[model samples]
Target: MFRFFESLIDPYPGAVPETPPRRLLAFLFHYSRPLLPLLLAMTFFAAMVSVVEVMFFAFMGELVDWLAEAKRERFFADHGGRLLGMAALALVAFPLLVLCKSLVTHQSLFGNYPMRVRWLAHRYLLEQSLPFFQDEFAGRVSQKVMQTALAIRETVVKLMDVFVYVVVYFTGALVLVGRSEPWLMAPLLVWLLGYLVLMRVFVPRLKLISMAQADARAHMTGRIVDSYTNIQTLKLFAHTQAEQAYARGAMDGFMETVHRQMRLVTQLTVSLQTLNSLLLVTMAGFAILSWHQSLISLGAIAVAIGLVMRLRMMSDWILWEVAGLFENLGTLQDGINTIAQAQAVSDSPKAQELSVPQGEIRFDKVTFSYEAGPRGMDDGNHAARQANVFDNLSLTLRPGERVGLVGASGAGKSTLVNLLLRFFDIGDGRILIDGQDIATVTQASLRRHIGMVTQDTSLLHRSIRDNIRYGRPEASEEEIIEAARRAHADTFIRQASDPQGRTGYDAHVGERGVKLSGGQRQRIAIARVLLKDAPILVLDEATSALDSEVEAAIQEQFYALMEGKTVIAIAHRLSTIAMLDRLVVMDQGRIIESGTHQELLELGGTYAGLWQRQSGGFLGLEAAADAAPIGAAEGQTRGEGEASVPDRQRQ
Candidate 1:
């Protein structure tokens, strides 16, 4: 009995060898444990309601028989009063019992159960890592969570009601039929056999249909979400028609699957109804034959017919509920699979908390690669080469030293920054801060000492003040403004206003700060980083998106702000890093040159070649102009010396 109940409740157990299909029941039991008492109360009430319903049916049958036998006055005189009183009490009791059951079921199942399950699932989803969101479409995830909760709730409630009622109706009908005419039991057994055989043939098909429907829905949801998120891109490219066609294709596929499943269900339901009707006819025929042979009384025939009808209704309801249960089980399984796949990252039990420290970074021969292959990769390319983004890269930054990194595109510059931030752990070697290996420290703690401003600045759709304060949540308004002033952001911020005429810092930055210009956004990002005031700073093409005039202005401010801070700046523009204390040139994931600007120029190596190519046009012309002036000035000074005595007399 306990195992049966457990199976009904929890559907999924642990991932163990030889686990059964009933594991879904195990999941329900696990989640429902807290609601066990309420469930028990609901179950008790449900059983009482079922019992009353069966009793009501029996009582009605007896009342009909009593009316039919009204000619026997002596029989009525002996038991008429007792029968009337009992019938009256049953009529009242049955409805009262049903009312109580309804209240209890509504309170326990409809109200509390869904709320608790949703809360638990939502909390669990929230705890998942960043990769989970990356892999799933937001619409699909939202749909799954909401529909799964609703499906579970409906399945549980209906299962409870159907199981209890079926048991009571079947048991009561069987006993009554056996007492009146035992031969009726044989037909009941036949009916049960037919129902089971029909279910065996149709249930698997229903599950398949449901699974296919759910897959289609998820695909449609994903397509819709993708289109909505990239709507601006579609509009910019004038691909509105193409996007609409793609969405139409998804919807058409979904509708086709839904129609196919609905047709199948219709056929199955019609066949089941026909079979039930035939069983009813057969039962009625047998009961009439038994009455004619005097094997059963008229009252017994009435009772038998009532029992058969009740049994038929019970069977139909149970079959339909079971079918729905199978359908819901498939949906629940999909949700569970999503959740299981989402648990990709888990912190080690022995992982240690990182103590805050001064900025001192070291990378010791780090190698890293992203996941590859069709299943692992987001892109659907099975033949693509699985290559490492970085290989055996080693570098060190002493406390308070500012270094610049120059690299071409796909040279692992961003990968290096990501590694330093511990977004992804290295495949080999170790990264350390202040002599402590990064892996040993908590991720939150390790990030606390680092401040970064990347090329693509993403600000929340919020007030400018809030976006600035996001860098340091506890920062005061004055401190934020000060940081803004330092990053040269205050002048533009003061000129800005929202649609409502709220000026300066209170202006709304549209989604991803779209309302602001690229330069303004970059400066705001810089201000955010300045407010953070971390010991280590990483600037990855921080000024690349700005125009030259704005870039020059920000660059001048950046130099002053970078003082006394350890900085790692990655940029493709070599001229920007010309003033750095040291520049490191990287190629194919390795540093090829590291030296001062003048020393690298003297070597005339890759760095020098790049520098000359970038600055040759302007610097060469300026040098020639300055050389001509130096020679003329020298000749003038020599002429003055040769004629100095005569020039003094003339004056």
Candidate 2:
């Protein structure tokens, strides 16, 4: 029965949740609509349980009066049947109702509701644009996702279990007291009004405090996780003290919010206790006076006292539930702010799947700027206020063409590659793949045809086989091994063993492949991309991490991989790209020169100047400063100063 209830709702529903409403009730209703039937059943059982509880008190009153008046001999004949029937109802029906309620609340709603909330929320978050993640703390965003799920579950389940039951029980108690003697209802009526007034005053204040508390907790978590994520950097820099101070700032802020929340809770508790005392004293006095006046029976007096005492205990429980409800609501609101955002880089309404049969990429008069930020907003003149990474910049990679991008840091080399991958949308003009506008195509399909290996590679915390096969999930073990071998990663992988004693392909990689060396991670990344075998390949300093010997060996494999694919390679090592079909020199968001390595060297232009300044196959820092401009209008090269290669070698 527990298992049946547990499996009643799908934990990971495929349907996307609708835009969450800002209003608390609306948000609750939106998520609750799917499980409305079960929730309704749970509420019914809860109310029935409350009703049975009230009937028990009513029966107790009747039994007290009967025992006082009935003859001892006839008592069994007269009231035994009634007492036995009540016992059967209490033992059988009441326990069954309570069991059903508990099953739904604990087994079904507790587990499944939060899982669904997280699944839907996580799915929505995945669709958010890259910049959305870049702008926020990964730890904080994740904290919100997790916290929101539990909060929503607690809020809903508590409402069904505690709030609904309390309301029905209280209403029944009021009716029971009034039927016993009209005077008995007055004290309860006054107490109910005062209880509501106190709640109205304290609950809202608690809610506001809870919001601050939740936000503070997430911020503290983010700060701590940030420190942990960059622990190596902190240790290398010997900045442990500084890191502690940074985290301590967030912790102190969280403590302040906690203090404020607890202060409010203390006040609410004191106020509620006072209200409870007045109700108990007033009900007792009224019950005693009614019995003295002979206006109510002895049993009526007993019932009134019993009901009021139960309410006193219940009031405290209700107060806690109500306070918690609002607190969770605050957390839900905080989570919604992070998770319920519109997608910034969604495809067009009529988006089509991109097909790249020819592997031709064209940047047609493209313009882009990271300065205008993710939303692409700018002040005043669009061009004047913004510093563009690319402005009216156009380049093309012909089908199966091997092109290299040469530039210094901040010269838009990586930016151009990012643009090609559509990681960031361009400001003006369109990028097309084989005559189809990239913006009009679905992002997944567009990326499906492109394989890229970045300089900074991060691997998932999974086994070696899993990370390698991520590029092509359906690839067989033999194919994976083959790909690893081609990338020269097989030897290390074969020798690898994690702390858990899993060796070779089964060995787990630590977070972000931290367990592996830089070269090893790069090799694994290369193996994955090789397995992917996309038609359009991008290599951004792909071989930068490997030693000369490994690089030389991998060069042949890269050549094989580049065959029949339109390849764009970015490299600061001039000699590595010296043999490419074309090298485009970029500076300050504009292309200054473009030709084959020999052609550019013969032409004696910026590329030639950069080539001449190479120190041990890598461009010197001085080359970046000196190779800024070309007298292209006059068709003349900049003068090669004393900072040239021969001068540097002698120095």
Candidate 3:
């Protein structure tokens, strides 16, 4: 019993696999089995209560008939003691049944089941690959998870409620009353057939509209969160009205779908009410006629009327229950559609933990396209023609070599690094670390061997101390402070203060380190990497945010940190890479020039031309394309900068 509740805590408790069509049933039953015994108890006791309800009407009829003075005194004398005992037993049982139902219901519905389902579903979602998240909104995904769990609880509860009552009450009513006037039961039979037909026609339509409304609601939520997350951008663009209009468009879609659903509900209610009214009137009229004809007792007429009224009330309640069930069904279908997807890339069944002895990296005859065009289009035919990010590019980094990759935007520099990190599996050829194929190793183990610092440094919304410790969770405080000092982050960290009354390592950096400056975030990132101290290091525009003076000061520490580590540095600033062992310049994803900075300049090749145009030893996107020809500006010194690309050339 304890294990059953424990099972709920881990949403992904190694569920058996199911086919797509059976997924909904499998999802429901997976979490419901634990409560099977309770559900059965609830169903049995609850059904007996309906039987008691039917008896109550019969009791009322019997009491009324006995008071009429026709065989009244003798009937009481013969059966009064037994009758009183039965009434006392019923009075005790009614509240007992209701109490049992309430206690079981509270545990099953309002206890931990819904939240457990939610936790499990969300945990399953967390296992989906990066691309899956990239394709949808975080807010929408979270919303779907919540809806799916609630739907599970509501769907089960209502199914049991409606099914139990409809079967037990209807069957009991038919058996008890039909024995006397069997012909009068025809209206109820007709009502049953009509109700079935109505549900069959209207339920699907209700489900469709409900699904649309859920989607619209999710989309609206995503849009509003998108705006909140980028509030600064909206403020900078001065587009408050534009944002409102965008949000209004989503709201309109949501409102339209909801209105359509409500209209269907109203129509169904009126139609069901009319059918119920006809059933009530027909049963009452037939009972009066039967009594007048001397075919049944006066008590039977009252009993018939009471049963008809009870059936009317039950039918009305059941209709709304079915409607609520349908609404939740639509939500469940939507949730399953989003949450259930085949994982794009996962660790191979036989993949092993990576053991990096010496991280000598190599790209062996590699070729890859992003599987979509630059514009993110994926027309089936066009995918085959997608332009390659890298083609037949081969490179080797000897252990502990510090080599720099210099390239313009879109030249596949990041793609190469991304592939090495196994963020995306390669299309062809192999990326090897220590001669071990990356694809054959678990991603967690593979990534642990490499440390990276990119241009856009994002930090968690946590204290500076925690963020730095994130790199190496078990690192001693002394080591953490040492890393910060090496990365030159300790001084500003100690002096910095914000409106939140926090300073230094204890201060909270807002989401993506929004509370800190560009340089501050970069230094924290650098400290993190320093704390990590992986065998392989990648610096993609690592010092781009630092001014020249700071860059010069930090370069000494960076070089010291890079010693004896296999380093792959990418920088647009010429001076940053000028002192590296070799400069491998690329254009269009192919190596154009390679050698030391002086050696390449002496060669008077593309690198030489580019060297002359660099400003403050840095190359910007516009300048890289419009660099003067070799020796064109020999008299002019560096830092004058190249002009922007010609419009025709850019086109």
Best by TM-score: 2
* Clashes within 3 Å, all models in order: 16, 0, 2
Q: Residues 176-260, candidate 3: write the lDDT tens digits.
A: 6787789778877888898887788788898889888888999999889888877778999999999999999999999999889
Instruction: Tell how far residue 425 is off in model 1, in angstroms.
Output: 2.6
1-651: candidate 2 lDDT, tens digit per residue: 888999999999888555677677777777778888888888889999999999999998898899889999999999999999999999999999989988988888888998898888888788777767877888999999999989988888788778889989999999998998888899999999999998899999899989999999999999998998777789999999999999999999999988888898888889988988998899989988888888888888778889988988989889888989999989999987887776767777799999998989999988776545443555657654445556688888899999998865556677777767777777888899999999889988998899989888889999999999998999999999999999999999999999999999999989889889999999999999999999999998898899999989988999999999999998888888777789998765678889999899899977887777778898774535644453231111111111121211111
Across residues 462-545, which tens digit of lDDT does each residue of candidate 1 receive?
A: 889999998899999899999898878899999999887788999998777878877899899999988998888899879877
TM-score for candidate 1: 0.78
Q: How does residue 230 of candidate 3 score in lDDT?
A: 72
Q: How well does model 3 score by local distance difference test?
A: 0.77
Model 1: lDDT of residue 487: 79
* Each prediction's TM-score versus the true structure: 0.78, 0.93, 0.85
* TM-score for candidate 2, residues paired by index: 0.93
Worst 10 residues of 2 by lDDT: 642-651
Point to the candidate with the largest lDDT. 2
What order do candidates take by TM-score, descending? 2, 3, 1
